[model samples]
Target chain A: MAKSKTHVSHRQYDDEESGWACMNWFEYMLVVVLASLLLLGALTLTLFWALYYAGGFAWTEEPARQFNLHPVLMVAGFITFSGFSLLLYRICRCCRRIYVKLFHTIFHALAIPCIVVGFIAVLDSHNLADPPIANFYSLHSWMGLVTMGLFALQFVVGFFSFLILLCCEGATAAFRASLVPIHASFGITTFMLAVATCLTGLTEKAFFKLSSKYSEMPEEGIIMNALAMVLVALGILLSYAVRREPFRTQVKTFVTERL
Target chain B: MAKSKTHVSHRQYDDEESGWACMNWFEYMLVVVLASLLLLGALTLTLFWALYYAGGFAWTEEPARQFNLHPVLMVAGFITFSGFSLLLYRICRCCRRIYVKLFHTIFHALAIPCIVVGFIAVLDSHNLADPPIANFYSLHSWMGLVTMGLFALQFVVGFFSFLILLCCEGATAAFRASLVPIHASFGITTFMLAVATCLTGLTEKAFFKLSSKYSEMPEEGIIMNALAMVLVALGILLSYAVRREPFRTQVKTFVTERL
Candidate 1:
């Protein structure tokens, strides 16, 4: 909209290109490296943390083992899936708009069950404790629930606005224009809330399980911290991927002319 | 800027006027209300949490008393001051650019000492304990330090780019234009990091002190949770305030034409 017209300088085009522009060798490699690192780091650390400390996953027979699934699923679902969703438009910029939308929606849809199951696993763990621990007591849980609610709300709004309403004759261009930015902003906000929840949850677990040993920086604690950093990096990269263009309409001309 | 040159639809002009346009009565009132709520919530909750739970501020006589200053200063410095700095442009949009810059810089400068003192208070409490607690061990501590470092880096960069270098003939127009977006992004990132740090620290403290009582949701636990919620709300509101417009250039034109 208004951004499409703005021109700070030739440098504005360069600045936009640096992140949002077509692929160059260095920029392409940087994206690949960042995406790979985020994917690999989230996978390896979640598995390591789960298997080594939380005792891996299991079925109904082992409730404690079910508890292990929470962090793993959290990393995979909340961080990894959410991150990939943020990267979807960037990764598939050449794809049809419908294709990108489908992929984005599917990715987030897959994430939902993982998170739901993860929440259930944690709740189950608490319930199965000798003297059943309380559920939703901590700030982590509060924030987690809020993020999930917002995510679901965002999903519904997006689904209606982009998918369903687009097919209907009544959907106005004005509405879509306004909704897109808010949708994107909420997308990042939800991802960040997820990251914050994970960080706090990790810290809580570290202290609860390690007690005095946490102060010593035990292996699990180190792994958890490393995972946290990876999540932070992913968050930053995701922001880079999804942040709105400062100059949109002119940017299109610049990109067209340059290409 | 190219923004001043391009024309979108009349609707875009309207949209730009809605938020990024001039300060309309409703929008102005909304910002004022949000800022007031954020400041009041942060201050009141921090004080309530500290006084009711941590036993308000004190000096050398009791290290625990000294520890009370940490949360107070964190809310005041990291959240409140940082937030106001983000809002400075909007708050003083009618003022000259130099006046806005001066106010922003001074606010941030004031925040630095608050954060520094807060950090020292926590360190002092750890050292002065009966059996000195370890320093910089927890993820909270690590992330908090990292955020502080980023904030400091951001301050120095901003100081040089905006205040010092602006006066020098060598500070090219292109350089200043590029610096603005990055500076704004980092400001928000640093603030989010601070909020995350505060959440984790609060959770850690609640559990450490309350233990099982926390599960039952003691008055202190409730207060801490309230404080945490306020922080989250403040973060959300800050995001609404400072997020970079995707259509900045077009926005300027739309605003100019509409007004």
Candidate 2:
């Protein structure tokens, strides 16, 4: 039974490879290019909103302005860096699997500092307010905590299971293969959670800062809403990109290699 | 090639059935029970928050109280009913495929009235307010619009393609089969969008209603936050239930029947 299953899979792989040639490269390119733009666009929109409307970044010296860094950096870390990292599998489908894994790790590694600094920026902004506003009280903050925790867990587990286990590739192959779907599913869930957290955060900021002016749809409010829309679009686009089976890596090692 | 592929799938299906018997029913029971509780829990929590804290529901007479119906009914329509409809595939795995489809359709059909009324309640509440609050201006409203639009589209398309096309199943089998994944994917996406929209709406309400008291985490604020958390938990659980391979209907007709 096992031999027959392997033989069938081998045949299916060849068939899928041939089918890939007839597949519309146009659609593939469009998804890749649009995803790339949206990944970068989300960060760009956040930066533009922060600098132009909300006061731009500052450190301990100007805590109110420092609050601006929270959205920008979080978008940079959680949305842009993390999004691009997830997209690497689809975008670099032709690349060697190890190289793709390295790039994935490298991109997520870059996001950690942004997340750390972003976390501190918000904390300082809240703590150093003249009135010293309480932290972690809002729904946004609670969701952010969950998103960050999941991100950290996914990073640690993924790094250990996929990369560290490679030291005993033959012995660990079955164990690692079993982990792939769980990792992939949770990775997408984490991304969705991050997007949800950002949406709530945007809503909180709009109401807090804009107050009555928000209903009138001021320039800054519109910018922030547009930025929110971009993030929503990213959530839809990224989910589709990742879930679409044809876009999936065709090789059998996908079970263990192309996480 | 086609004959070989069908033979392989037949054998695989039998193998999977045996594997299913050996599979831990405990985990399946846990997931089903937890999902059902969370689905009902989400609606119950929303109702508790609405009635106890938000001043309960009304129609056009008391616009402020009428607004409370928005959250409760939305949770019922979007999360509870839609959730159960989605879960029917997993929950009734042993039932006839046509029966499962009918139940799926029936549940979603029930959600439509709730969604329609929930939408109207909010609009009337906004427009009839003493100072006629503006509509569709906030990020929450915008997200809600997109979610509703997608939900409507998914319902119409699913009903037509899956059910209506069955009248000519032999001719439409391939077309209906192609739509299953798309319908399933978008169905989950719409659910996720609804959850995200609810989170944003909850944040908006927390800041608006709780005002200065929100920072202190008052009882009402906590209730709302707790409701938001339930929705978040639902998002994770439902996504896992739908995406998990073992929970999927282990039948050949999944392509054209189980959906």
Candidate 3:
């Protein structure tokens, strides 16, 4: 009977008060961290597309044109992600959102291991490898793919869900004011643009493999390159070109007000 | 006895636990937010600098270059700062030290706003000003100077302090291992590079004022423009070349370890 009473009290605490596993603040922060991480991840992937897949990747060739590009983009991308994760911690630091804290702790810890492994794979592929091929593709590629995929899905889906719920019920004023569509659009666009670019990357990597085998850029290689360029160009335009007059104002206003 | 015991207990809590203001996680976040806001406030000064010290001023002449450029760069700069802010936040998210969070928040937040404002001013002045400037000392030019000055100070003073503490702890194995020199070098070089480039901006604005009054390039305008190009070329080299090696290593090591 004593045990039952203690368990009941604890259960009530979990349900009605902040606990380690469930709370509003925790959940909200979890979403923020996830969103930022997703952006960082997308940035990294986009860079990889630019450096390795976009025609400049000679890891083994003396003066490998294939792999020389701006190192800051990738470096800054990770740093940005790390910063966002910190923001998440701060957001929950003030509140007692046990569930978010738990989520934050578990996911970040798990993410650390993944990030470490991915980084090692990248280092090995770049510095240690003899080079024509960095042996970077197998697990390194897929591990990154999965990690990025998880972040992308979590951020987009979470935001979309929150937005829909807000619209359906007319979310509280504080909550309503917080919804930012431009930021969200930037988030989602960065992710989707990354994916579209990645597809082009796969095609380019194959072309590199084929061209290396033949010792020449084949007819198909040239065609694929042009196709890839077009896709990336379109993506860049979409990402940056929205800054013009009337449309920019409408989009910004809607996004700020709605979110 | 009861009153004395209660007084002692309250004192103990004060010592052991952070109060709402000084050292709690929430307060730490508040400091960071406060710093970020300060950085934003600092940007307003940039605008005033241009107005007081710059050369030509005619927003009506270049609507697209004027207002469009302002907000576009503002948005871009903000995005950039936010991205880095997120990374910094992630790094120390779990840190419990009072001084660590306090100083870290202060420096990182303060540094970026200056950079963002300067960047926007420079970019806007060059591209958005519509009609090419006959001088380099306009409202925009002065704003750029302020931004540059604040950025330099923030990087050298606040950044070094933040990094000193960081290196002392040697927390992340990788952070301690190789990031030190690269981190420190960028701290100095970015500033020097900015100084070299920003002067030409002032010259350009000055020419604009003279051009507006006299309707022609001053004798010095031609020389100043040439110097501007040279400075710009050097700045590019500094950014892309000198910064690249450390940045590359940092990027690789960072991505490899932290992801």
Candidate 4:
């Protein structure tokens, strides 16, 4: 691929310079928007697949639901995220720095399987009645242990990295400007999941009942899993908002320092 | 505090780098090692807790065991995993690359409650007949859905990352050299969970009878559940083994490339 002057970040894509619109800006934006939607849609289908499986079990009156996290693990898992990482790799060539792309690529790859296997061994065979094969009490035992174990590592990494930005590296001004948007984006994602996980637990017992009464349920809680999801969405939004304010200042500093 | 000529990776240390011997290479290693052991030990406890709950319910004098995944989830999920996540922070300094650490962190955090609340919602209040609300069946139904959902995300992330490495990067030597270790680690983890999830599902109907002396039981299946546990262990061993060959090559590479 020829090196293009176009620059696109996670939040926005630049016009004209991006080659995305060298021919036509409107067409380019539409394509980018559609690509984003396509990515999200692919993800949503996986969720629907599980629901479909459950419905198949309940409605079909057979144990047809004994499917492992199959379709995703072998086929989807192998395809989707790995594919995206490549997309990111392409995006990275135009990135301000190699480190950002490298980090993001590595993260997307590692995070997925930790999640896949962790879910399989701990959560795959579970239900509210049996608890996990290990916990079986409050729905909070071994799965929690494993999940948190991995997350714990993430937190430390984040804290230190954040520290580096604040003190060691970013305090130098050049580093500070380049790092904020992504830093916030990742932070927002983290916060989103954190809040989602918490509220998801809170509402789990209520969801089935809530799902049954969806027609009569309050608009606020229309979906069984709505509340937790909302919080997650909010967290992601706030993360963006919080970080957006600093971008101009950051970029200016970055360019000036470079000059 | 001064910038120095010597540098060390997060996982390595030098004796002269620090003042206190107790604070140096061996001690630091020991601290991290001990901490890891504690984390693992807590995991063991969490697993046993779930087992205890579910087993209690079925093994009870009543028609079924007294406990299930709920107890383990609540006791271990809510409490233990969080506590251990904190411990892991101390051990590894948790910072490596964002990929490994954050992947670890996010998984542990989201997974715990997802398992716990998922279990609680499915298991908390139930009668013990047919579908057996508080038993393993319903638990498996609901918990399976949630666990599978999370794994789907993981698989997509991992599979696509691998694809991206292979594709958008143009199969360049640089891409191959840097990503192969990560790709290998993630692949091994994926395979481990794949086998484990499949076996768990396949053996679901026969778990309780794994080791039973029932003359009528199949020869290779004294009790599928007993065998499930064995498979879990073996699956884990294979998980570790998946890395051995690749890791050895990486070690050689590390020596040749960096060390």
The prediction achieving the highest TM-score against the true structure is 2
Give the per-residue lDDT of model 3 (tens digit) for A1-259.
Answer: 3445788786786665455335444544454555454445545544554554455434434333423332223223323343343334334333443444345344444444444544443454456446334332322133235435545554555445444455564545445443333233334233323333233233434333453332244544443334333333333222222322223333444334434
Using Cα atoms with residue i matched to residue i, what is each candidate's TM-score against the true structure?
Answer: 0.86, 0.91, 0.26, 0.32
- lDDT digits (tens) for residues A1-259 of candidate 4: 2235334442243432355334334533443355344444444544454464334222112223433343334223322343334234223223454354445446555646745663453344443223223232222232233334434454455444533444565455544443443343333233323332333232432333344333234442333234323332333233222222123233334333321
lDDT of 2 by residue, A184-257 (tens): 77888889999999999999989888999999999888988998888888898888777765565343345445
- In candidate 4, how many Å is residue A119 off? 34
Candidate 1 chain B lDDT trough over 10 residues, lowest sum: B250-259
Predictions in order: lDDT:
0.75, 0.85, 0.39, 0.37
Candidate 2 TM-score, C-alpha based: 0.91
Fnat for model 3 comes to 0.00
Find the 10 residues in a row with the least total lDDT in model 2 chain B: B249-258
Instruction: Enumerate clash totals for all models, in the order shown.
Output: 16, 0, 42, 85
Winning candidate number (lDDT): 2
Poorest lDDT segment (10 consecutive residues) of candidate 4 chain B = B239-248
Which runs in model 2 stand beyond 4 Å of their true positions? A1-23, A249-253, A256-259, B1-23, B249-253, B256-259
Task: Report, to 2 decimal places, the DockQ of model 3.
Answer: 0.01
| Pairs that clash in candidate 2 | none
Candidates 1 and 3 compared: the better one by lDDT is 1
Model 1 segments beyond 4 Å from truth? A1-32, A244-259, B1-28, B169-171, B244-259
Which model, 1 or 3, shows the larger DockQ?
1
Model 2, span B16-60: residue lDDT tens: 766856664666787789999999999998988888887888899
Of the candidates numbered 3 and 4, which has the greater lDDT value?
3
Off by over 4 Å in 3: A1-48, A51-53, A60-259, B1-11, B14-41, B48-56, B63-259
Deviating ranges (above 4 Å) for candidate 4:
A1-17, A20-201, A204-224, A233-259, B1-35, B38-42, B51-147, B160-259
